[model samples]
Target chain A: MSSERGRGGKARNWLRLFSRKSPPTAPAKGKRDATPDAKEARAAREARRAQANAKKASRPAKTMLATPAADGRHRICVIGSSHMVAYKLAADETTIDPRLFVHFQGLAGREFAAIEADADGIFVDYEKLLLSPRHLRPMWDPLTDAIAYDAFDSFVVVGTLRTSHILKAFYEWRTTGHFSRAYIEAGVEMLIKRDPGVNLGQAIHQASGKPVVTLAAPLTAIAVDVGDQAAMDEAYRETKAAIEKGFHARGLTTVFQPDETVLDASSTKEIYARASQTLAGVEHEDEERAHMNAAFGKLVLPDILAAAGAQQAETGAPRLTSA
Target chain B: MKNPYQSLPERAFWRPSVSEVEPTAISDVYRPKFPVDKSMRVVTQGSCFSQHIGRQFVTRGYQWFEAETPFTHFPAQLSRAYNYGVFSFRTGNIYTPRLLLQWLRWACGRDEAPDEAWTNREGSVDPFRPAIEPDGFASDEEMLASRNGMIARMRESLPSIDLFIFTFGLTEAWENKESGVVYPMCPGTAGGTFDPDKHVFRNYTFLECHRDMTEAVEILRSFNPAMKILFTVSPVPLTATATGEHVLTANTRSKSLLRTLAATLSEEHDFVDYFPSFEFIIQPPFKAMFYDGNLRTVTKEGVAFVMSHFFKAHGAADETDGDDAPRRRTVTEAENDDLVCEEVMLEGAAAR
Candidate 1:
């Protein structure tokens, strides 16, 4: 009897250790029931697992999808200085805008028309169209003509040349005691009031929230009279510094051209020798005169496209339709 | 034409559609709608290379509008550093084509010049002068009236314009929180001042960029009604980024997105076109074109190679039938002249 009592006691002890009433067991089909201590423990475990997963996903990927492999048809609109229009024509393959064939004078308007007609895309030659009596008839008011606001997909500003010119002219005028910072700021403000569409930040904010890309003008080619080599070198350095300053102030991106740098030799003679070989008899005889060439345009286009493409890839934007 | 049933050379092996899938370089596969030609008047702006394009136009006898004469007479070396008339002044930056159009409109007098403040005996009063250079009117009304007159003259000259060249430069910029002024450089760089209260850096997303660019195109078209646009992205890397990302990587990401967006938009819109200047330098087979010292910059020999290919592709082969095109211009003897330097008027204050 005593042995039987000891075995029962051992069995009872085992039950107490293992079972513990199964933590106030509830029906399997219904909600789980647990003591507060047990419930907290369960929640903690789940939270730990989630944290681990989050950590794993946060690491950067080994490779990024930046460039695309295929080529496509495009509808583009250009607005800016003479350089933008001229370069576009020199690099294009279509002749839709035959008017663009003229050299420099009407090039912006012609190119605008050609791209529009050839690609069946819209063209706004702000330099020509905005200034034209036909478009701005009765005058354009940002407060009123909302139709103008709905027309385009993008806006590109060649800020470098224009800003440089403005700055230069402002400085020259300043020297003559006519222009001041107040004048410059007022000019900027006046432009904003004239065309509500002129506010790039707002235009960007309203139009699918896209960002504006600004291009800085290139450094001027160093110019020289046939005889004064020293003066030419000094001029080149000084001008480059000034333009660089202007570009920096404007927050413009620069497409560094080959000629922007000083060549192997410092002698004005050597500089002239090198420059003459490339620019001899060009319409603009001075070396300091910087102009867009087919080669230069071709060289920079791909980089721009690549940069734009990478941004699109990151943001999950759709690729352009292939031509 | 012999036996029809005889073992034909596996016709199934070659399918016309399948053959069309041959691999091609992205640059060679896409063709711009507007062929570069002498009859086309060309305008270029944005970035340093823009000058190169302008020079090429002058060399080829194409009309390069906005070209400053007498100034062009400067030595080539100096000219590269003193480029003017290559871009517009209204927009302070040049990453997008849209800003270019807006500035153009302002310059052409299609829109009213901004109301600028000038400091005189009274201190910071609204000035009554035209915003554009070479002419300053007394009031906004006068400027607008003058702009109307200028627009008429520009319209008469419109027929001569044939091409618009725009080069994309940056993806990073700072915008004024209140005034909405977008600075080309961060406040601390160059001429701008670092005002934490006003300036904010922005690393724009691709979607935002595309929309801005697209709107720019629309605005441009509204004006010309028949203009062609050719877009190019600058290959230069970013000097800095506000995102705190690696500057190099940031540059790659920024440029890649811009390039892709430009390509996509060009494809989607008929009037829009894109050039492969980015590919001409960045991709392989063309890598040698950059200078040995700095891979970022192009060399004289590299420039020549690029120009050669460009001329060949555009059907503007050099007049000579030699192994290579003859050198167009050499550095001038008087390239270091001091009188020709671009004078900065606001040296101290402008540097703020």
Candidate 2:
């Protein structure tokens, strides 16, 4: 039994010699007492952290979100030229929220209806209105008084129309040897007096209180094939330029330009042309012009709607208001 | 080795006796952790996906601005072309980071004023007419100074942007001949007719793309030092590839390189981050769930998925009645098969 145990122990020792072993351990050392400087340093670091915390706590919190107004109603207003009225008239009322009240101001009713009915008659009437001193007096008076007016949470205006009309009136008066600078100045004075108590720089301030936006004009959809189309295009361009000038002068923010190119004039023309082509076989050619039979509207509507939606999202205000 | 069942110690195969322990409370799962208090102002820009970020921000009550947009009722019908100044800026889509930065500067009033002559409107003086006519600015310096004033105004109006989101789209672009400016598409596709002399094709290398991206980011950062960046690679394949390589191969190569570069850059920079939008859309499990019938365009469902994932990941998921809840519906395998076949047919038609 002793000899067997001896053989087993020898085998165990041989196995141990070939096997891997852990590293040798170091001798244990005695703990040193805490130093005064170390304690002081740690205290200082803690105090600094505490100071930072206190400073942070004392700072005013920044607002990341806007709170909705307590009153449910979100006021909005629209102000623009005749085209604006036309576009707004075409708008689907159901899409708009009931909480918002939209007030359509600017050239509407008879003035707009006449223009829609006959463009030439409307121009002639406008010329007569401008040439006659009596017609101008009533127009300027209301505008001036309304400029100081309130009761609007948001204002949507056709910048081009306002700008173009005023500029054209001023230009024709100056060139035709009819109205003096003093008269023009008087008209401008009335406009300034009527100025919506808002400027472009003040837009953000106003928007923060209640949103205000100026929309650029929509491009004309007249076919370029006609000679009058070129003239109309030029007139449209002039109108657009005038609107931009007016917006700049008033310091109002405009979302877009009314140039035909920007409005997808090519696509619009294509639609009209295609409709005309399709209607060539039918008797209702005029009906084809009135209605967009093709999906052209869909293609353009998305972009338009997207922009409008973006505007609404950005502004975060009601589209209309009523007191 | 000698005997299969020698009288070895029982300890060799003995397992520890099991003891029953009481179940822990579920409280651990609901334990509160540190809350983030810092208010981060993030600005997002890029391809269509950027709009997703903006929409999410608005929906969740986060601060964001879509500069191109203005307040209006008929948002669906708003003209995007005009909003982006595509006609005047002559830059379509503004897909690339560099152009986006440039656009931001223009929108914010940092870039020099555009030439008044370029836009011939009544009442506004054509500032560039002299150059094209009898007399104008004596030199480019004079014209630039005039333009600089407009830029200054734009700069002043810009709000301090904090975060920038960039999405990489295509590697191909066309350069102009006279002004040497880059156009988004070759002239003929959208507005400009194809002219060999005026429009030149450019297929940017990965390094070139990286350099441009880096430059754009740096420039934007210069405007706002605190601006953090999030880069995403668009998974949408090119509508058409100008590169001679097979369209599919070219798109894959382009997207892969861009994704790699974006990841590499994000790793290198502290402020820069990469979002897994590309992965989420292109992954096998998602399996073209984000694509429309055309396979190229994103469907509303796909947009919703992306938006949901984004909101969930960002911790901005709507908690109020779970407004964005998943809807459940059962469809037979036959219906699924038909849908798939229809999609395939549509995609084939679109490709042709």
Candidate 3:
């Protein structure tokens, strides 16, 4: 019950489950409802887990992951801000896209900094870099390398458009019903070298001539106390898609946050973000409300990896020859 | 017993009106036919100059009625840049009385607006309001949807308007020859390619302007039965003339016709009144100093002087509103200015 309450951000579904179950009658009005048999419930739970694991295993080997098996997997670099946490978790756990190992590069802060690059490859001191908690100071990481150009076949970049800012706009727009065309123009214009993430991604793509796939930022959750999800969902998806359209206009591939993990389209289910905030290797929960965990990555990876695979085929530039 | 000239005030004569007086202190240019209160839901539309009225109404504590409110989080700087709150709605510059009538007719469904949208290699555009969408809409459907949204808001809000201030810009316009669907700007100048067989240039005569305005008022009255309609003529001359006559000659004919019609209409209709903005700003004794180097665009001092005179007579403005006055001069304040004449888009042809 405590665990269920802890992960109850998306509690409506669990409430439905509880309502449908024909549980044994309570002893009295003051007492809690009877628990289902532990052995039976445990067996059923294991069975569901087994089915999910089998389903994940059934997918092709090229699905994106953090650590590549090195035996014949395609390797691609994943670059982002704290938003990259989910990709790392998903890659560490399950099959996301077809068999592709991610050389994930991520960091925190400096959202408006310009990119720096020279002849010896896009500048980064990989040895001094730390891994991805991002809760305290901005930590930099290259999934498993300092990275030269030829290390990966392609790259996936997240944190392009200022999703958090747009999320704030979406909430205010939804609540107030005032939509500014000028704000949209400013946001669209910001998707260039002026923005830190876009600058880095553009610089790296330009240097390597490798196809770059950007991850569209996820919609943030707003507290929903009423039945306004239908309206909010439409606004959420419409806004997200519009932002994606701007990137599409700029000649880049995009991997949008998938639909199923989206609860109310305003934000993802708690199991994906809120529940797994403190996974075994990660530190404190809720250090950032925006970052997602591996659970979300698992649900969203297929769409992302599929987009990447499609881009690779479309832009048939050799993956790594010159570098 | 006294002749009409003997009964008139000293300001009615040229010496007090223009000659030997302080240009700023000469106040008795107009008297209101009906009272205008600061509380009335006043809506403003028409030529580029009308924006000055709308902005002033807002800054001066008038209940400037706006239908198209921007989002809550939309920043003030970007909101100005995006051209929100420039008018009651984002219909861009209406430019002429006929355009206003056409919009009113379309609003009440008294007339069927042309269903076709204009397009080029870039994107689709609303022929009636080409510059409303900066880069143009993604498709005809999108353009129509957006235009329909504006129409819906207009129909919904027009009835609630207590005062409607309109400005007449020009007599010349480019429109669909078959349907008489007039555009704010001619085809090709702003968005579409010009096809001689389809599009025609129209210089509206007095009868046409009067007739259109009459019908437009009837349609508007259907929204708010007792709405007061105030009209003004833009002092800015025509940017470029479509008529083969010299631009100056064309400007004179156009302004004269509009002024004559406004005077006639004010005399005829008890509800209608004309403000002598054009007469006060550009008519001789001031040496046309109100005009910039182009001799077309009105200067900031000119706009300020005109608006000050107007508010003193008919508005409830104060010193605070006067602080941000004369927005016409600087480019920054006018960045999101919708007070543009689409005919100016034809300047290249004259240069060529």
Candidate 4:
């Protein structure tokens, strides 16, 4: 009998492997005449199990369905700095062009410097991206560590160049009349050369031999009394052309922020700037932060895809049509 | 009985001062007449070698005044290539005292700059400083505007300096024969044409150099009366000489004349002092160890040794943070040692 008891004790220990709570036992019969209380406890346990199973059934699997790999659409990889959060949120709410399947890969705060490119493809640290804050991670998981060069037909690089900064350079030069036009132009080139995003985009394009499009960082939402709208507009026009020429010379298509989103040469409309979100998914109303909301991204999406498609067309690739 | 010489210090005797001590360890070479503490705003200008002095002053945490500064937003390489922050102003290699006086005259509005501009397919070049812009200015107006801006900045900055360290570079220069305006280089070598009737080669005599320097100092004093002047003669020999004399003898004559004038000025003026940087490099006892393979460019070690003496005399040697001390090479040695000298173009001009 003692040997049989010892085997029973070992069986109980095996059941306690992942938990400290003892296994439940049948109520001691007739010890306290506790049949009614045992029935109540048994009913409580059954109700808790039912509730958990029901909650599990109601939750959607994987939050949303993954985009099928063989979907009949042109794939475009959208890589960028922290500003890709808007694009991801907008992509969720709005239907992207039916012809394109966009994938997002980004991290906040200059982490793009960690990315590398080679003949195989652009190597993104998938583990690092997954470990980042929720707002900085792509809503959809990247299946592979590296996005192979053949996996995408074209690329859209967001926030590589800040057009607002360039506009400021031009405005200062114009108002003060202190610097020569050539000097201002050279300064703009230096600014372009020094941006981390632009450097990465150049590397990716060179490594992959793929058509690429670069979008300017969002203009500041702060309202400014530029004193003279005409002068600011003139500076904006010249700066835009110079920046475009700079990107074109580097073999990337330049797509500026959509016009309806911005208020002036140096600022975005206050409405678009409202409800801007941080990389950690907090809504920020600060004007100086310079990030844009989902509305701005929604408007900018078509332009980005259009530029990407246009570049693909130039390279004589077959174009996909929306259903 | 002791004679007058018997009571002198060891430094006063040739045996103890020169023969006994090591060449590098030789001290008492300079005793500053006035305190040149870190608080003083110093401006340096002269020939190519003067570049090292200004840079060292800045590196040693001294207040080396820059009259015209480049845009801080740009990378230093781009700004440096455009010849900003290389000197007090963008007067590239003022190799002669006449050129220095000419720049001062323009800055003080005592004389208007000549309208002559050198133009080729590249762009319009400033005849005064032909190689100031890496590529010449886009137009004549652009070039003149830049030149005027420099002069304005110089005019505004001179009155603020606490000390002026000027190095004498060369006695040879080219000038407009009729107007007597001197150019930094012979016109044909850098930009303009070589017309015998228009431009004349001048190896300035000691009297002319002294007179021009005196007027330059007067103009500086007119701006800031309390500004102290310290003079140095560059030990760098000439790249080439236009005169019939051999390059060595020509260089010796040029250096000897400048050195004598430097000594004379220091003795005559209470506010002026001379430093023996020339003797430190060119003296026979040191054996020219400071020169590079070309025997012209000052090596990194040479510049460090020269600056060590300068800092030691001012009692600033102890004040240097190891991060910015002259011994550590933060900037590349090649980049630090190579001076932006337009005079080097004369070598290429000679080859052709």
Instruction: Estimate every model's Cα lDDT from 0 to 1.
Output: 0.41, 0.41, 0.64, 0.73
Tens-digit per-residue lDDT, B183-273, candidate 4: 9999888887889999999999999999998998899899999999999999999999999899999999999999999998899888899
TM-scores vs. true structure, each candidate: 0.40, 0.39, 0.63, 0.82
All candidates' chain B TM-scores are 0.66, 0.63, 0.91, 0.94
Candidate 2 chain B has its poorest 10 consecutive residues by lDDT at B23-32
Candidates sorted by TM-score, descending order?
4, 3, 1, 2
Give per-residue CA lDDT, model 3, range B96-169, as digits (tens). 67888888888898886777888966578789888765567767876776677788789899988998888888
User: DockQ, per-model, please?
Assistant: 0.01, 0.01, 0.07, 0.20
Question: Whose TM-score is greatest here?
Answer: 4
Error of 3 at B32 (Å): 3.5
CAPRI band for model 4: incorrect
The residue-by-residue lDDT of candidate 1 on A242-299, one tens digit each, is: 4444333433333333452333112122232222211111233444344544444444
- The alpha-carbon lDDT assigned to residue B2 of candidate 4 equals 100
Q: Mark the regions of model 4 whose C-alpha exceeds 4 Å error after superposition.
A: A1-68, A124-144, A222-231, A282-287, A310-323, B318-334
Docking class of 2: incorrect
Q: True interface contacts reproduced by each model, as a fraction? A: 0.00, 0.00, 0.07, 0.21
Of candidate 1 chain B, the 10-residue stretch with the lowest lDDT total is: B336-345
| Among all candidates shown, the one with the greatest lDDT | 4
lDDT of 4 by residue, A1-323 (tens): 01112211221111111111122455655522344545686678667655654654454332111222655566778876667666665665665444556777655554554455555456543334444464234323222244566667787777546677788778877785555566667878998887766766776688788888876687778877887788899988987888788788778887777777767676888887778775556676565457888887777776777777733443343233221
Looking at model 3, give its docking quality level: incorrect
| Number of the top DockQ candidate | 4
Winner on TM-score between 1 and 4 is 4
